[model samples]
Target: MTPSISVVIPVFRSRTLLPHLYDRLASVLDGTNAGWELILVDDASNDGTFEAMLALHEKDHRVRVVRFARNMGQHHATLHGIKRSKGDYVLTLDDDLQNPPEEIPAFLAKVDEGYDLVIGKITGDKAHSLSRNIASRTVQFLVGKILGKPKSLSLSSYRCMSRRAAEAMGSYSGAHVYMPALMLGSVPADRICNIPVAHHPRLEGHSQYTPRKLLKLFSYLLVNHSSIPLRFMTIWGTLISVASLGYAGFVLVDVLANGSAVTGWPTLVILISFMSGTILMSMGILGEYIGRLISENARSGQSPVFEEYP
Candidate 1:
């Protein structure tokens, strides 16, 4: 039977937590009215998480597994599940066990309210470092600025999307694919809602979302989703050029008035330094955009799955 709901969890070095997660998911999903399936995408964990996924699949027919050939990022793994899931509505959550399985019903309840996408908003305490929390908020702010999502809308990995919204994402082939950005573009803002969900501390392992990865994600948002960087560079260059021209005019007028070359080592040094910095900054932004374009042209997000379990 085709499942009415599909749960897609992207696993990354959570071997110790898989068994408990599977059991909890089963318990919560068993009472649902609609048929459901668990689709676990192993994001090439160096640990034995893939083996555990295979074991879970063998233990339960509803558990489906996809093992990636290489460690594609979490979003890529989620995209793989989104494309392959055979359910009317798909739910995606992390495998770190921070997002409780019990909240699945709340997400479903929100979806029943006619929203095309219902995100599980983490209202409870998140046991993370101060830096991590700040990074998350920063990313959210940038995403809102670039993708035009509501700054108030707190997006989590745990969200449910209707088939229509999921299908809308199929047309996207960008390398740095942020699922929430694509989702915001695909679904109307009014139709997207959030439900409060409980959050727990990590069960065993630390999060893979290091500071570096969060920065990388931010960079991806800047380069892939918006041209703001390029626009900023253009504006900066124009302003600097105008200022330089004005400064030159001032110097010319001073020389003509005094009948001597306006000579100041400090002024020359400052102008030269400012102009050089502006040029370098503009070049760096342009180079970043060009690099993104080249990567988008060369690489497709369609990662290869080395194995699958039915």
Candidate 2:
């Protein structure tokens, strides 16, 4: 039987919080008149998180578990569960219980209202570090500008997406799996909506989102999702080419009119260095894009499953 909703949670060393998260999700989901299932995806957290997930599956057959062969980050783990979801609506949330499972209904409410994607907007005080908060803001701004998302809507890990929205993400096979960027691209701006949800402090351990991970995600977003970097290089390259031509023309006019060139040889050397650096930078950008393309086309598997329990 198909469930009305499928809850996809990415687990990473959150063994202690699993019991509470499962209980709350079950409790809230049971109240609604909809069939639901829970997908617990372990992002290769070798710290025995899969054991807890298996226990939950034993307790309730509605629970599904998948352990990756290696760590693929939270977004990759989530896309795996979402692909396995057999529900009308695919809901995602943090395993730390920061975004309460109780907020599931609010997201569902918007989904029921025909919204393709319903994201949770953190209301009141957010329980995160300044850097994490800044990263989140930076992601939202970039998504808005690059993906043409509405400024009014916000992005969060806690959200509900319709089956169509989930299916639309099938084209993204690259390693750069930015969930929000893919989602915003899949659904139209008008179809995406946001509802306020309360955010709480962590229940057990620190966030899996470290500074390095955040920067990596940002880098992938810039390179994989948008062509702005290439465009910037192209524009600057053309301008620099024009500037070099103007300088060459100046040297020509000076040699013809007076004696040698213009003034100091340092100016010509500086101009050469500047243009060479820009050319090198542009080549590097093109190489990165080409490398990613090769990686994308030659892809063998995605989120390879090590173990999955019934």
Candidate 3:
């Protein structure tokens, strides 16, 4: 029988928190007295996370584990879990215990209210670094703007989606998978809602998402999710071209009026440098899109290989 809810957690370098998370999650689900399953995807963790997942799975038939051959980022691992889930409603949460299992009831309550997708918006201070918060908010803002998310809607990692929404989202086979972006793009704005959820301080290791990784993530979204960058390049290139032509006309008139046959080397040098830089910048944006296309074409095997499963 299919479970009423499937909780998906992407396990990275979180070996220490697994047992506690499982215990809490088990108690929480058991209290509901509804059929439920837990899907934990080990994202190629070098730590002994896979072994721990195996132990958990061995102890509980409801717990299923998926192991990746290589670290393919959080979105990929979560996508794998979503695909393997047998629940009518799918919930994704971080393994870091920061998003407490205690909040599951609230999420489920909201889900029962007929929202196709419900995101657990963090209420208080998140235990992440300032830089992470800034980067995350920036990404969220851009995603909201590009995806036309409602001003009231704020996407988070801790969220629940109906099975139809999950299946629709899982159908996307793009190499660069931003789960929030994909969800917003696939599902209608009216069907999504945000519920306030408690966020606790992290009880363990450092975050896997470094600033560099965040920057790369933003870059991917910029290139693949929207045509804004290309449009910006177009607008800037046109402005530069028009300004250069005007400058050229000014120089020609100045030389003509002054009756000087010698060209101003400095003016010519500046114009050439400016035009060269613009051309290179435009080419670089095009190259980024082309690179993404090549990657998507070359990509294969969407499912992460399972080391073990129930």
lDDT of 1 at 306: 20
lDDT of 2: 0.81
Q: Candidate 3 deviates by what RMSD? A: 6.0
On a 0 to 100 scale, what is the lDDT of residue 24 in model 3?
A: 97
Question: What are the per-residue Cα lDDT tens digits for candidate 3 across 1-310?
Answer: 8899899999998888899999999999999999999999999999899999999999998999999999889988998899898888899999999898888888888878888789988896577898888887888789878767787887789999888778877776877877877787667777789999877888877889977778778877877666677667666766766676667667667766875565676477457856765685677667567656644542332322211265
TM-scores, one per candidate? 0.84, 0.84, 0.86
lDDT of 2 at 199: 95
The top-ranked prediction according to TM-score is 3
- Can you tell me which runs of candidate 1 are displaced by over 4 Å? 260-310
Task: Identify the runs in model 2 with alpha carbons over 4 angstroms from their true place.
Answer: 261-310
**Model 2, range 1-310, lDDT digits (tens) per residue?**
8898999999999998999999999999999889999999999998888999999999999999999999889989988888888889899998999998887888888998989888899996479988888788888899888767788887888989888777766445766687877676567777888899999999878998888889888877777666667667666766666676667667666666875544666457556856775685677568567756744542432322222488
lDDT (Cα, tens digit) per residue for candidate 1, span 27-133: 99988878999999998888898999999989998999999999878998998888888888899999988888988888888788788899888885467777887
What lDDT does the true structure give each of the candidates? Answer: 0.80, 0.81, 0.81
